[model samples]
Target: MKEGIYYDCINDFLNKNRDIETKKLLLVAEYTNFELKKLESYSGEIIGAVVPFIVYNNEFFNKGIISCDLEEENNFLLIENLKEFSIEDSFFKKSKSLVVLVDGLSSYISDFLDNLFQNIPENTQVIGGGAGKMTFERDPVIFTKNQFCKDSAIIISLNKKLNLGIQNGWEYLEGPFLTTNSEKNILKTLNFKNAFEVYKQVVEKDSGKKFTDDNFFDIAKSYPLGIIKYDKEVIVRDPIFVDSDNNMVLVGDIPQNSTINILKGKEDNLIKSSGIATKKAMEQIDLNNENYCVVVFDCISRAIFLGDRFVEELEEMKKNINPSKNLFGALTLGEIANNGDEYITFYNKTCVTGILC
Candidate 1:
């Protein structure tokens, strides 16, 4: 694998890695600095980039990068048409593989993965995040080597071994309310009551705090919804906004009839869980022989709730993983991972670590 890092914008990526011969490139950029619309008209072999809060060497920075492979170009496949991906495709036959995804639309990611996992081999490991800004604009830019796009996603297949671990420190606060009514990412009701009313009541009761329109986000940041999964795995769903009708809009989708619990967390627990997640991920792979990089897709909500203490979470990750190894990733709106047992899932307010070798 060949990698190049640049302090400049997306336009400078090719210049920095001119000598690297690669068929597919995985780009990670600072969300604030990247322009998504500029690459829409670009005409080149498919290459794509994601916008997230980037991490490197235990510090957060806004640097852009292009990671590519020269010799493994044949093993790499750039998938644009999610509907067209199939098991019979030569790309799925590889022995050990990793899929890096940069999705322009978070809503479509679940659907895309549903189709993707059905065709890919069981040994394949997937990692990536929803690429966009907090603005929640209609056109979030995902870029290619020479083009930018909206409402599209880039899927890169690489022949490599990856060990993944997922963890969320948020503790369950209330009942396993059945999702009585929901539409895509909007929660209309919980246990047949107005979603916001139930949420507000539960939070106020638990925290002894009042909820106002002005302070909703401040109060809601520490309290998110957890979707129960098999083997006691809970996928978190963050409530981003409350609609006029008091319906709660979430960062990711919550399926109807599914049981969910309200979750709450503290700074100490959140920070402590980061170390546990890192340690578990590192334990999955043999570090002595392989060249590995620890890639983390941590929820941005955690950082917001943690404030200055967020740095302590990063420090925990660094300490748990081999201190000499490279640690880098993005603070994402939503994180994606599949730990072999569960289906590949999209989660909010969670930490996902991938030890890629």
Candidate 2:
């Protein structure tokens, strides 16, 4: 794979790469300050976020583009409906190994991912994220070389080897509380009481912090809900908004009847965990004289919670991986990683690192 970064303008990147030949191209465009239409091109699919900055080749660019070239034609797949979609046998006939990148609506992430993993081959490795915003105003926009889409998703398939690592540095605060009532991504009640009331009460008690509608996100971001899995693996759900009825809306899904816990994290530990996650990912891949790029899917909530110290977290990840390796990705509303596990989970307030060679 070959990677290039352009910072002057999207036009510069598009004009220069018009003649390049490759099996597949992945574009990570940052739209923090500019509009998405400005970067629209007539070449490859673009999957990314309206993040504050972009990370490419272990460096930062406020508004830039990172493009990569792969060497296989049938290696890319773009799907709309996970359940109805089927991979052509011929696509994977040449190479069974695959890397999947997902950019979907925050509210429908869990349902999309659940159906996605069920239909894909068992050996397929996946790593991607919920591509949208925390604002909840306009739905996140995804584009494909020509048109922009909303409330939809894009799936990219690559025939490269990848090593994935997922980690959320949150510790349990309370509850094996049952999700008694819920809709897709909204928690109506927990253990027979209003979900927000239970959450607010526990957070106020644990941190001695008061909860008000105005400051709910500021206080709640440090504390997210964890869906308990086997061997104590918890899939985190970040509560983004609370309704008038105090029903909490999470970034990912919380199915009815599932047991959950409120989790807490300190800045120091969260930063440390990034390094550990990078190390864990490195352990899964063979790094012997091969060129690889590290793609990160980090939760935007972590940036809000860490404030200026978020730079330290990124630095920690760089420290763990080889200094010469390239790093690039977006700060997503939620992260996705299957890593050959029993389930492909959609997570919030976590960091997922993928070593692709």
Model 1 segments beyond 4 Å from truth?
1-15, 23-32, 35-46, 62-71, 74-88, 102-105
Candidate 2 runs further than 4 Å off: 1-8, 21-53, 57-62, 81-106
Task: Please report the TM-score between candidate 2 and the true structure.
Answer: 0.88
Candidate 1 scores a C-alpha RMSD against the true structure in Å of 3.3
Q: Write candidate 1's Cα lDDT for 1-357 as tens digits.
A: 333233445566545545544454555655435555544433334365565566664666546654544344435444454444443456667635554554534555667767767777776777777666656564545665456555556556656677887788899899889999998788999889998999999999888999887778788998999999767788899888787888998877789999999999988999988888888888978756557767888887898899888889999998877766767767777888885534778888888887777
Candidate 1 positional error at 238, Å: 0.9
TM-score of each: 0.87, 0.88
| Model 1 alpha-carbon miss at residue 210, Å | 3.7
lDDT of each: 0.71, 0.71
Which residue pairs clash within candidate 2?
A: none
What lDDT tens digits, residue by residue, belong to model 2 across residues 1-357?
Answer: 344343455666667767554443444445534455754543454443344345664455555665656654545666654445555555554443444444444455666667666666667778777656456555545555555555556666666667888888989889889999999888999999999889988999988999875898999888999998767788899887787777898877788999999999999989888878888888877758467778887887887899888888899898888877667777776787876645787888998888876
